[model samples]
Target: MTTPRTEHLVLPGVLTAEQAAETVAGIRAVQREDGAIPWFRGHHLDPWDHTEAAMALDAAGEHQAAAQAYAWLARHQNEDGSWYAAYHDGDFRRPTDLSRESNFCAYVAVGVWHHYLATGDDAFLDRMWPVVFAAIEFALRLQQPGGQIGWKREADGTPVADALLTGSSSVHHALRCALAIAAEREEPQPDWELAAGALAHAIHRHPERFLDKDRYSMDWYYPVLGGAITGAAATARIERRWEEFVVPGLGVRCVLPNPWVTGGESCELALTLWAMGESDRALEILQSIAHLRAPGGMYWTGYVFEAVGDSRRAVWPEEQTTWTAGSLLLAVAALGGDEATTAVFGGDRLPQGLPPECCTR
Candidate 1:
């Protein structure tokens, strides 16, 4: 496939076509030859964010680069189907975080499914099936009876008993993608289907199964963002927490009572808005964060703002990151009407797996 030109990418109100191209170039620039994309140069790579950056490359029409990034995951993945919480840039052997996070391992399915949608490359999908399957299998091993997956495993491979709402909800999304891959390959995985249903049920009906993290923006929105909660429920959830996590005329706060507006979270929220068919609101949210855009087409990780009385605010923490740019590109792609982006993020294009009753038959 020919590499996509930036002019064709949808940038909405916040980015010019040229700026969009720069963002693609910026993500490509940070990628290692081994196909790994880290947070930035000299930074470590985590599975989830690395997958996010790779998806941005695919959205930008860098198909080979995106495939390469996934190859890195396949090459470096632990035998247990997990990657450590962090891997030093370009050095898979040097793990910086010993923990094996379920959400991190689970995210590969989302990335793999998105890549297949973008390219329609059956061979690529077949080649990556083992990787996706292993990752999901490992992740599901952490799932509790109540449907919440454990947050992570200790370095010694013991599952952490606690679950986080954000992580479990995200895993529910990943499990859906994993099942889609299996179906396309004519591979029946009843266990995966049930696991997905259970996870969704846990996310929707049993928030108590996961630890309370109401103060964090991800915990508030992830159930909706991950597709476990939809329709009126999704709308109510966003509205209920709007005042807590969102900063009008600015962006989203990572945590309540914190002055930080994070680019990654804001962009994901924009996608969630788009998925709910609120393009106008999504575009506005994206526009509000234009201040995070860098000259090089990368976006700052986030800007910390403090209100010093009189409603005055100041922004700081100046640094562009690959994942931030990736997320922005993904959100813009959905707005731009990229079929794959719309399918995976906007439309219910990816399967959400079957509920328990269907699984029995």
Candidate 2:
């Protein structure tokens, strides 16, 4: 239950084995009775963050708990194969009226596949097949004319914005995971493969069709980390935006002209660096962000937009976030050469929820 024990869940050089284990224990403390993982006990839970927390649980060898987390998602899924973007923390909680985010809906496949890979339990995958199938079906309803996935859908199923590059890139990874699960079960998924390959191609060749949000670092590097881009192309993209967003040793800014450095985006950038084979630099990035950690295993959402003369005092207070810890685990997992993350969420393979272009080279 201590930090040191949690550190052993990952390989050396990522966290002081002690630090990694401590973070894992922090996540363990947040699981609800229903197996849903809130950011913190009594805090609201969202599907995307919940899935990341479950993956952290699996990484910590809490297999049964991780499985229960997915079961919660399955039981709560809406009729159209999606879940609401948010949930209230209290009892008798209904959907919070937020639209079902396509990317969040798609993420379950990757989480399910990761659990299966970690545990090698075919029965678990079998149990999850229907849920995974339904989620992918719901996500696909938002795919626009160009193979880009629309960003979100209302409760009644109306589409929202044009496909977001970041969300679709994440979906591209999810689609590949779903296909892998299908392959493991010897299930036929020709359409799934076709959809994945096409989505990857769309991400590769057509970046303009997506909403322009280069303001966020996730939009800049996630495609590369998620395997939607590679070689000199990926490096070039990082280079083009590095000066605009990165703030040296602290972390990455959520947007330009903002002095804030967020642990989540910093860790994600580190993972993307590892995906590009720059593991050493990725390690440095992870190490630099360690300073952001607070008393518990939590991290501030970001540094303040304004800093004092010493740059030590934050002008505005920040929220301590679970996803910040999740992002660090994902980064550490990538740096330590964790095959599961690379295989499930990395490499050139498209994940489960993407459209046809995902698998195309």
Candidate 3:
């Protein structure tokens, strides 16, 4: 089903070489010649999801295309060192959402570090250093008193004071990756180091500092997915909400009691499970999402099944998405021990925070 060039991309028996090739092709098909990958052919592109798709390309050995994706970010970045929350149809001339989300801005660091890890290209990292620095500077500016960063800044420059737990957790992970990049280049960002420490503290000791979105599945799994929680604690966190968020042989629910299982959230949970050393469980989770796969190696955003009353379950959202495919590839790559994927998700390889020696939060 795939040419010989794609055979090397296989992840043992987990994914047939053909499947991997088709998935890569599917992602590449949605990416523009200029390197911007949209959620779908006509859907909006957000910074965080765009980077996720780029990382998937790198995992597939499409290094030049991945670099081009980063180039697109470098070209369209605002003077304030951030991209808007969403660009309509991935067009620089048509940004649909003007909000600058902290998590969205910080995610570029993760993608840059991941690319460097995959390619070992010093020049690429060099070119990206200023971009990462500016983005982190912008993100840290929104860090509140309790180490929880504010959610976003409005289009008109008004700061949203409320912090989101899931977004903060993701930003926490990005900070660590940014620190690693700084360390590699001998750039001493003492402020970032200090801020990262405080952020981790907030995530670990003061979850109450963030806005409560406990109803969403992201609040249940993102800390572990973000590398802020690990070992016994991470396992416990997954266990605490597994029944509420996960549906056996189907996938993970986007939110409870909604009967909606989403491809992105399900794949992310699979990656998190792999990071926790539960490979069997992780594989099972990935396998359960097979129904979400479409013919072109694309995946639907989500599916709603018997959500209310006795209505039969059916796929919701008519379009397939780039980020959905991206998340699946990343999870599969990690399970297959792809060097960059494992390094990025495995918290052990990065600089961890030093918790308070003595004192309750």
Candidate 4:
């Protein structure tokens, strides 16, 4: 029997009520007592993937666990409001990668807002507001004049001026969520509003501002997934590369000219399709990745669908990442009409910051 909290997570061909509960439990099991959610028990934790897992907990109505994940982020946040790109799961103080990524920092706002919407906990929102504010500020400080955000700052705090399309698009979505949080607090941030508009303008009009990574599926769809592209443009963009990235019965390819299909990318594409109002197609995409589902309700990171001599398709990485399962839960939540997941991904109620003049002309 599906508990009310997880009832909405059930999706035909994707997840049953019991399976959904087990998946939620699997994520919970990976979360440390201090609230860090690593990719798996022995894996490193990145802020972006950690937050993605936390958001999945919220989608499953594991509100306290999600809140604890945010609390962990607050406790570990650098004085400058950014987190290291990766941390050793066994020790938060031991960062495995010291680069501070703008998109990684910005994603906290999205997760925070989603938790608030899911639980309606005013105190949690109040507590996390400063965290979100500082994070967005840190991210915006890396924004280029052309509106695309620099991808990261080196360990020595040197900013990398070259931007990535996927990272900036994700930041655009984060900015809008940050703005929504501000609106809820009755705090107006005109600067963030302006930054968001400029960022979206760059995403929609200035692909040249970003480094070329077109072979990756993320670069192909993140503008739409991040809510920076919509309507006919979004539909057209997805169609343009549908055959290139999507592997009909397996999942989405992680990159071009590779036979690997990743659960995370496939689920994110499903969410993107769901956000575009193609719920049936989204469901089909979710259903297609059933092979990636692992025992105990977790999901494999990806599969190498093209076989080598004497071998069939295999789970390439031999790991089940929390974020992969998290993405699946989120996609299922959105498709199953979970209000908070729908609201966050649908973008209908989120504030669209002031449009830059470039966008108008």
Best by TM-score: 4
Model 2, global lDDT: 0.77
**RMSD of each predicted structure:** 2.9, 3.3, 2.0, 1.1
> Where in model 3 is the C-alpha error above 4 Å?
1-14, 307-311, 354-361
State the C-alpha lDDT per candidate.
0.86, 0.77, 0.87, 0.93
Compose the digit string of candidate 4's lDDT tens values, residues 320-349. 999999999999999988899999999999
Off by over 4 Å in 2: 1-14, 90-92, 308-317, 348-361
Residue 164 error, candidate 2, Å = 0.8
- Native RMSD of candidate 1 (Å): 2.9
Tens-place lDDT digits, model 3, residues 147-230: 889999999989997899899889988988998999899987778877777777787778889998888898889988888777
Q: 123-190, model 1: which lDDT tens digit per residue? A: 99988999999999999899998778999999988789799999998898888888888989999898
Poorly placed runs, candidate 4 (over 4 Å): 308-312
**Candidates sorted on TM-score, descending:** 4, 3, 1, 2
List candidate 1 segments past 4 Å from native: 1-4, 307-316, 356-361
| Candidate 2: residue 349 lDDT (0-100) | 50
lDDT of model 4 at position 15 = 92
**Candidate 4, TM-score vs. the true structure?**
0.98
Candidate 2 vs. true structure, TM-score:
0.90
